[model samples]
Target chain A: MNNVYLYNDSFNELISLIFYLLKNNIKPTNIKDVSYNPNLFEECIFLGIKSKEQDINNIALQFGYYAFRCIYYVYLSNNESKELIIYYFILNAIKYRKKITYMRNLKCVHETLRIAEYVSHETHKMKGFTRFKEINNNILYAEIEPVNNILELVSKHFEKRLKNEYWIIKDVQRRLFSVYDKKNFYIIPEENLKLEDFRISKEEKEIKEMWQLFYKTIGIKERKNDRCRMNFMPKRYWKYLIEMEDEL
Target chain B: MELKEKLKILADSAKYDASCSSSGSNRTSKNGLGNTAIAGICHSFASDGRCISLLKILMTNCCIFDCKYCLNRKSNNIKRAIFTPEEICEITINFYRRNYIEGLFLSSGIIKSPDYTMELMIKTITLLRNKYHFGGYIHAKAIPGASEILLRKLGSLVDRLSANIELPTENGLKLLAPNKDSNKVDKIMSYVKEKQNRKFVPAGQSTQMIIGATKESDLDIMSKSSSMYDNYKLKRVFYSAYIPINKDNLLPTLEKPPLVRENRLYQADWLLRYYNFKVNDLLNENNPNFNILVDPKTDWALRNIELFPKEINKCSYYDLLKIPGIGVKSAQRILKARRNFTITFDELKKLGVVLKRAKYFITCNGKYFMSSSYFKKEFIEANIVLEDKSIENTKIEQLGLFNE
Candidate 1:
């Protein structure tokens, strides 16, 4: 009989599930994490079987820092088999210690790394791609639809950088907003939520218009390549760009 | 004037400068607004597909000198605009907060004098760094012939400093930008390099050269870049293809920019910095220009066919890097994987080697995956470059089947 695990895709639940699987020594055939669902599994497991957070953290750290970070990043990804990939990745890591990360030739570690790179690449791009506009006078607000669940990952980046300012980086697809004041940030996951409409400040409009002008004029006329442009900043992410909205 | 009008004039003036690098300095934000990364980040790609990592703008378009190729030359019939210290600070802080830019790339034309212009730039950046508590990346150009005291003061504040070389040849600078001399530029670069122990410009210095305007060959450009790297230990030597603005007798009579030559120069530049290559490795007096059809690496590989069919299992990392298809990352991957077991053709491809280009040069163990026809110099010469590798891969598979 095949053992399958399902979770609501939280890291805490993932740790508990990992602890439960290891304690019982039940090899899982499939994991219904994020976008995955398989019909071949015979038994199901949810987040009820508890494991200490400290235990999971300690075990994760033993597998090397990069490998452990990859597990967390893999959890943030929307990949279907991320849970299973991490399960195999952690098993090999514990079985061999730091040796598994160097063995990129392994199928399990390779796929997890590919997912980690994808999620990290998105986070890096969104750092530069997030556009903010002043809604009232001073509150800077931006809306994004990233491919992965990276709202929490990027929250630290903004928190470290934008201190002493009121700012909100909202991931519209996840209905999550990381709001930061002068001191700290709060992540709000509202149910059935839509961003409220407000009048754009005149100074904000003027600033964005200036930025749009710079974006258009800065490019060389002789070497215009929209395909290259799309490769880096695809049209799917254009909804958030104030410069692209001028075309509408 | 309105801020929009100033930005239009200043950005148009600053567009000719090709230095957009924001890497190399990993400055941390000390409870401030932004941080710099050693591995650079591209915020967005403009229409030309060039990465717009920073908000590049000139503090002023008003100038005293009449450089023949410049848009903001004093002789040109153009509107002049200058941003106040407050205005520049406002733009940097606001744009950075929106995450539209990595940081600021502030260059300028000489307004009243080099000292006066440098003072204004210093005032603006100091305000941004101190009062605003900004720890973001700042690349400021050191005005040639500025007082050493003023230069040292300016350097202490920004992350990176640069002195524009403008053109390759000394004669090119004398003829076009008459007032500016090569020696003055070198003096500023030396000052920045020598004074780094004082924490002045912690990211080091870089220079830019405008190509296609002068009668300098590719040999001249590469030779200068090599010397600049060796003598000054420069971080980068940027090559900007001359775009005719206010065309004059000294400038090239071109309808558009010579972008391909500029691109080739960049490729050759990369070989010098990362690949541990000298100038003569790719070019000499007879071979002044690179083959426009293929890149510099393939061009080198073709000339020295005796070096090829290097064994994947035993070749050194540097030799592997010299192959046309293998890059720094792939070569390192080969070294790392070889410690476990001998790397095969399948493993080589997985390690990110472009087997299409590398197939002519590399072999797996004792066996060459390429056919005997591919070994011939004439045959490989005829097919050294293809338009795109995707289409060429299909052709190669069919050819492989026939050969088998």
Candidate 2:
């Protein structure tokens, strides 16, 4: 009989489920997220436990801190089988201790690292691809549609850089917003955000026009290659990029 | 003129310069509006496929010299515009706040004198730094023939300082840009190298050399680049293809820039910097130019085929990097993955190694990945993918705006 374990969508919930299964000595054949559909051959077990911070820290202490981070980052990805991958990766980590991360030949460990890398790579790219517009000449607002749950990671970067300004980063894919108010930042679900209320400041149009002109003027006419431009800045990003809007 | 018109004129004049990197400086925001990430960030890509990291522009298009190849030469019949110090700071702050740019890259044509021009640039950066409290990346051009005092002051204010060599050889400079003294360029590079403190030009210095303009071969250009890196510890050396902008007795007329040669030179430059290969290893007196048919590394690997079929599990990190199609990251991955289990040929692809080019060069437990019939140089040569062949086929002539 295949025993399947299920958990809620957050990283903390996943950690709590892993801790419960490990403590009870129950080996899960398939780990399914709450949104996943179970097969007829699998016996599902749902552990709706709100895990403590100490439990997560204990897992980090047992498996190395980097291994814990890799699992956390992989949890942020949109992979369907990510929970099973994490469960198998945790089993390997418990056996091999800190050395399991270097074993890329292991299927579970390789997928865990690869998925974690994809999440961080998207976060890095969003650092440059995120464009902001001034709203009411006071608050800065930008929108992103990343495939992973990296909105919080990107907000942490801007929190250090634009500390003095009020900013909001909206993850359109996840329907969440990371709002910063000069002192700190907080991530909240899109509750009552009126899309029409987000208006561009008076001088914003002029500055954007000037930027578009500068963008066009800087490219050499002799070296004009749309293929090359698309290679660096992919086509999926063109929808939100102000400079690429005209071409789209 | 309006600010928009001034920006267009200055940006057009500054487009010839190929140094657009805003990396290697890490200044956090402390009581300021911006900060510089050490790894740098490219905000946009221009239609030409080049990264637009900084708001690259000239302070003024008006000049005192008539360099035949420059668009902002004194003899050119173009509209001249200059920005005040306050105006540049305002533009930089606004653009940075909106995330339109990572920082500012300010270069200018010599207005009154070299020292005078350098002083004006220093004033602009100082205002941006102190008055506005802008802590973004700033890459400023170190004006040739400027005084050491002025150079020192500008170096402290900016993140990176670069002096353009303009041409590859001294004779090329004499023929095209007679007003530019190549020795003065060397003096600025040495000054930055000497004053290599934490606060003085924290990102280090770099230089750019125009390719395909003069009669210098790829060997000569790579040799000069190798020596510059050895001598001055430059962060990077940019290679800009000579676009046919000037029609003079000394300049050669062409349909378009020799972009293929520029691409090849950049490939060889990467091999010198990262792959631990010398200029001589890639090119000798017998073979002066890179094979336009294949990349420099692949060309070397094909020539030195006796060292092939390196055992993937047994080779050192340095030997793994020597194999074609395996980059630094993949080689390190191989090293890490091999410690746990022996890597099979199928698993090599999963470990980030490009198997198409690497199959002929590497082995999995002393067994070749591909059949022995495909091990010949002619087979690999026929199958190797060309990245930019279409760039050579399409021919278009851009009308000369500066050198007309």
lDDT of each candidate versus the true structure? 0.82, 0.88
Alpha-carbon shift of residue A214 in model 1 (angstroms): 1.8
Model 2 clashing residue pairs (backbone): none
Q: Which stretches of candidate 2 lie over 4 Å from their true place?
A: A1-4, A27-44, A192-197, B385-404
In model 1, the fraction of reference contacts reproduced equals 0.65
Model 1 alpha-carbon drift over 4 Å, by segment: A19-25, A34-43, A58-61, A192-202, B387-404
How good is model 2 by TM-score? 0.94
- Rate residue B361 of model 2 by lDDT: 87
Q: Write down the worst ten-residue block by lDDT for model 2 chain B.
A: B395-404
Query: Over the stretch B206-249, how does candidate 1's per-residue lDDT look in tens digits?
Result: 99998889999999999999999988989999998888877677
Give the number of the best model, judged by lDDT.
2
Candidate 1 C-alpha error for residue B56, in Å: 1.6
Task: Report the number of the highest-DockQ candidate.
Answer: 2
